[model samples]
Target: MLYKLNLEHILFLDIETVPQKPNFADLDENTQMMWEQKSQYQRKDEFTPEEFYERAGIWAEFGKIICISVGYFTSKGDSRNFRVTSFYGEELELLKQFKQLLQEHFNQTRHLLCAHNGKEFDFPYIARRMVINGMNLPYKLDLFGKKPWDVPHLDTMELWKFGDYKHFTSLKLLAHVLGIPSPKEDMDGSMVKGVFYEEDDLDRIVSYCELDVVTTAQVFLKLRNEELLSEEEIKKV
Candidate 1:
C-alpha cells in the first residue's frame, strides 16, 4: 500500500483547461487545420470540428490551462492537515507561478506529484503546455530519459485499476464507491468551457479545480485504508 510512502512527500494536484482560443473559429489557419484533423478521429459524422472543438480542452495541443490547484499534507502534533493553493488567470502567468511553486518546494527527488489520472492526463498536459510556453521543464514534470522507477508521479486512478488497463474510472465514481464525499455538486469538466468563456468566472473554475485536488487526495487515502480528511482539516493557502 502507498501508506508506506509518506503522505508528506506527495503533492496532490488537478488542473482546469479550456480550448486555447475562445472558439474554433478563432484558431489561426495552421492550428485550425491541425484541430480538424485531430477531431475527425474522436467526433462523429453529425458533429462538425467546430462543434466538437468544445472538447479541445482535453487535448494539450489545442487547450490552455487556466488553473492548477495543488495540496500537500502537514502534520501538527497528532493531526495532519491538507493545505491547498491555486494559480489562475492567463496561461503564461499561470504556468510560471505553478512552475515557481514546484521549483521552490516540491523540486526534490523525494517529492511526488499525485493526481487521479495524473500520469496520463494532468502530468503530461502540464509538461506539454510548459514546453509550448517556452519554459524549462520542472524536475517532476520532465521525463526525458527517466527510468520507470525513478519517476515520482503517483496516479490514484491507475492504482485503482490494479493492472486492469481495460477499465477506466472517473474520480467522482471512485469517491462515491469508496464512501468519500462527492466533489461533483457544482460542475464538471464538460462545463469548464462555458464557465471560463461565457460566464467569465475564473473564481468558479478555481473552486471546482480545488475540489478535485482535495478529492484526489481523499481517494488516495481511501485506497490506502486510511481515515479520510475531515472538513476542518482542509486549509486554503
Candidate 2:
C-alpha cells in the first residue's frame, strides 16, 4: 500500500483569529496616512494582527479563536474532508477543549497536524493559549528545531512552491488554479472580527473555517495527482 499510494499519515489543524473591530480611537499619523492611500483590497475590512486584537470579541478580553478546522486525507483518496470546529466565549476554556480534541483524536508521529500558514499562526497561537491557560504544550507542538520536511508539520502554502520562499499564494488563488471550488463565502478573513463583535455569531466563523479546510484539502489532493471530487462527493456537514 505504501508503494502503491505513497501514503504516510493523517492531518489535523486549527486557526486562531479575531474579528476586525472598529478603530474609533485616535488614529496615528501613519495609520491615517495608510488608510488614506488604501487600495480596493485595502478598503475592505481586513485587519492587521494588532487590529484584530483591539476589537475581536474572543480576543477582546482573553483573545479570540474564531475557528479551528482539521482536515484528514489519505494518499489513496481523491477527496479530503475537513471537520471544522468553532469556539466561542472565554479563550482559556476554548483552548482546553481544543487541546482535549487533539489528544483524543491524534497522536503525534502517527498523525500530522496540517495548516496553511500554521507554522507562524495556528500552532504558535495554540501553544501560547495553552500556556496562558496553565496547560502544557502538546508533544508534537513542543518538538522545536526539527525540520518541517522531516516532521508531520505540513504547510500547503509552503509546499505549493516547494519552499522557494517567494511569491506567497493565497488559499483561494490556489483553489482557482487547481480547478477546485473555493469554500470561502462572501466574508474574507478581515471581516471575522466584525462578525464576532457585531454579529456575535460563532457559526459564521465555523462555516468560514470549514471553507478554508476544504480548500486546503483540495489543494493537497491536486498536488498528489489524485482525482478531485465532484460536487456530490463533497459534503459540508
Q: What local lDDT score does residue 213 receive in model 2, on the 0 to 100 scale?
A: 71
Colliding pairs, model 1: none
* Worst 10 contiguous positions by lDDT, candidate 2: 1-10
lDDT tens string, model 2, 61-171?
234464666655433355443334455456677777667766776665566776777666677777766776678877667767777555656677876767487768888
User: Candidate 1, overall lDDT?
Assistant: 0.92
Question: Candidate 2 local accuracy as lDDT?
Answer: 0.61
Error at 204, model 2, angstroms:
0.8
Evaluate candidate 1 by giving its C-alpha RMSD to the native, one decimal.
1.1
Report RMSD (Å) for each prediction in the order shown.
1.1, 6.6
Candidate number with greatest TM-score: 1
